[model samples]
Structures are given as structure tokens and as C-alpha cells.
Target: MQRILLIDDDEQLGGPLASYFQRYELALTQAVKPSAGLALLREEHFDAAILDVMLPEMDGFELCRSIRKDNDIPIIMLTARGEVMDRVVGLELGADDYLPKPFEPRELVARLQSMLRRRSNSQVQDTQNELRFEGLSIDPARRSVTRQGEAVELTGTEFELLHMLASDSGRVFSRDDILNHLRGHEADLYSRAVDIVVSRLRKKLEPLDCIKTLRNAGYSLALRRLP
Candidate 1:
């Protein structure tokens, strides 16, 4: 049975949702506060989490950050705001998905199933470990990128940016889109920061020239060239 941690202050909603998920054989644990949620997360191994945007003591964003710092487990955020900024912020914080309030229990179940399916599929196909294009390769498991068989050092943020672009070769992503996809929030004052990371990644990938910059658009990986 897949284990899921649900953090929300809505006692009425949380109780029913737990029962609903139980019918599907998903072992569900509920916490009404961020600290309790965080504590549960640290003490147990959960396949995924559903967190509410508003919580006592600490908000969902901060909880998401705390969870992300230690695990790559998929997260789905619940928000009543339903704003683009909220969605972006949730995604930027490494959430796999977000659903606004007043959602149907059935829809939430579908989303949870979808996320679980994707997670399973990703794990099954993750045997390659290394993705090679030209002389550059990325080891997703280790979060490492290499060029010309030489190990290249990258910050977590930079690696994530490169991984996002390279994983979807030839797809054009605008700065705003990339920011949301990578940072999961609005392209704020630090939106241009993507450019800086791209520049640094380009410098490291000089030998391969696999990263292409689209003026006024965003970044894309050149069509994969097998080394």
C-alpha cells in the first residue's frame, strides 16, 4: 500500500478524505498543523504528501521547503487562493502538482493516482542513470552533470535548471515558464537569475555546445547527439 501524508487544518475535509483514500487502499495519515506534518514526515517514509497552503504555526510553502530539503518525494499542494502566483510558488518549491480548494474528492483521488503512476513509471525507467548527449552526460540519481567525461560541479539550482531544459530537448521555454517550472512561483525580481545560471551552464558545456539560447524567448537543448 502506498503511504500518503496529508497536512491540512480542515478537520471536516481531512477526515473524509482519509476515509475516501482508505477505500482505495492508500494508507493515509493526517496532520492538522505544519509542525506535526513535518514531524511525521521525518519519522516515517511516505510515498507522497498533500499539504494545505494555510496551516497553523507554519505555512505550506515553508513546510514544502523543509520536506524538499531532505527528500524528493512528490508533493501536491492544496490552496484556496487559486492564483497563478500560488501555483507557481508551489511548483517552485518542488511540488509535483497543486489543486485548489472546493475540489471534489474524486478529482483529488485521480490526481493522486496519476502522480503515483508517474512516479512508478519514472522509477522503472530510471535504469539508464546517465543521459548522454554529445560529450555531456547527466546522472539524474546523483544529480551530477559531466562534459567530455570530466566531472563538472554544479549547484543544486543550476543542476535543476539544466536538467529541466535538457530533459526536454528542443522545447522552447520562456523565462516565466521556466521560472514557474523550476522555481514554481512568479518571475519575480530574481527571474533574471535563470539567465545567470544558463550562462554558467553554457560555460561548463562549452565543448558540447548542446544548450541553445533563444533570444527573447528562453533556453532549449539542441537535438541530442549521441556520443
Candidate 2:
């Protein structure tokens, strides 16, 4: 059984959801407050987490940040606010996925399964070629990246995104294409998560601006390094 942690104040919302998740072979542990949730996370090993955006005192964004500081577990944020910016902000803060309030239970299950699949697929090794684009180099075996011979620190997701793009420099990957590639088929086809992640990646890969955004189409990596 896959262990899932749900950090939401509303038992009304979490109760039935937890029951429903069990039907899909997911075991859920609910934490009604941020402190308890963070504590439980630190003490236990959960395959994934569902964090509510509207929590008491320290909101979900801060909670998400705290979780990322030490752990790389995939997170799905729940927000009542249907704003695009809210979704973008959550993604920027390192959430793997987000679902708006009043969502169907089936959709939530599909997303959770997809995220778990993505996480699992990322760990599988089919090939481990060291990709080099001039001064920028990626060693898949070490899962490390270096530019100009200096080590670059990247989040797991960020490194995966960069490695995917760098692997095929000429291919223009649309947002859906990249999301599906990273998060599997059940990924949201129109979320701004890709753009936010890409923006963050650009900042990290700075002084080596190779990721190029094409208006209306998508993004690509410019292999021609700057001198």
C-alpha cells in the first residue's frame, strides 16, 4: 500500500477522500494542522503528500517550502482559490501538482497515480550517457550538472527538466509535451506549472542562457554557447 499524507484542516473534506483513496490501494494519514503535518512528515516516510493552501497561521506555501528544504517527496496542493497565479505560485514553490477545490475524487486519484508513476519512472535507468553541450555538462549516472567546470545545484525536478531538454536540443517541446514527459499522461494539459518551472530553471542556469522561449510554440535549448 502506498502511504499518503494529507495535511488539511477540514476533516469533512479529508475523511471521505481518505476512504476513497483506500479503494485505489492508497493508505492516507491525515494531519489537521501544519505543525502536526510537518512533524509527521519528519517522523515518517510517505510516498506523497496533499497539502491544503488555506491552513492556520503558516499557509501551505510556507509549509511546502519547509518540506522541500529537506525532502524531495512529490506534493499536490489543494487550493480553493481558482486563480492562475495561485497555481503558478504553488508550482514555483516546488509543488509537483495542484488541484482546485470541489474537485472530483476520481480526478484526484488519477493525478496521484500519475505523480507516483512519474516519480517511479524518474528513478529507472535505461541509459546513463554524459551529455555535454560545450561548457555545460550533465552526468546522468551521478545526476549532477556542471557549467564551466563549476558544480550547479538543482532540485530533482529541475535537473530532470534540464536533462530532458538538453537531451534533445533541437526539439521544441510544448508545455503539455514536457509536462507529460515529466508527470506522465494524467498531467494537466494547460497548467502554467511548466512555465514557472522553466523560469526558475532559467535563473539557475544563468550566465549560460540556453533555454529559449518561442512565442506561441514552446521552449528549446540553444546549444551554441556564449563566448
Most lDDT-accurate candidate: 2
Q: Which stretch of 10 consecutive residues in model 1 shows the poorest summed lDDT?
A: 183-192
Query: Model 1, clash count?
Result: 7
In model 1, residue pairs whose N, Cα or C atoms come closer than 3 Å (at least 3 residues apart or on different chains), thus clashing, are: 88-184, 88-185, 89-184, 89-185, 91-184, 92-183, 92-184
For model 1, how does the per-residue alpha-carbon lDDT over 1-227 read when each residue is reduced to its tens digit? 99999999877776777888988888788898888888988899998899999888888999888887767677888877546677667766667667888788877777777667745654455554567787788887767777888988664455667777777778987888766654444223345446666776777677677778888887898856464
TM-score of 2: 0.85
64-130: candidate 2 lDDT, tens digit per residue: 9999887778888988756767677888988878899878989888888987876566566665777
Q: Give all candidates' CA lDDT scores.
A: 0.74, 0.83
Q: Write down the RMSD of candidate 2 (Cα, Å).
A: 3.0
RMSD of each: 6.6, 3.0
Report the C-alpha displacement of residue 181, candidate 2, in angstroms: 2.0
lDDT, candidate 1, residue 190?
Answer: 43
Off by over 4 Å in 2: 139-153, 224-227
- Candidate 2: count of backbone clashes, pairs at least 3 residues apart or interchain: 0
**List of clashing residue pairs for candidate 2:** none
Off by over 4 Å in 1: 126-129, 133-136, 140-219, 223-226
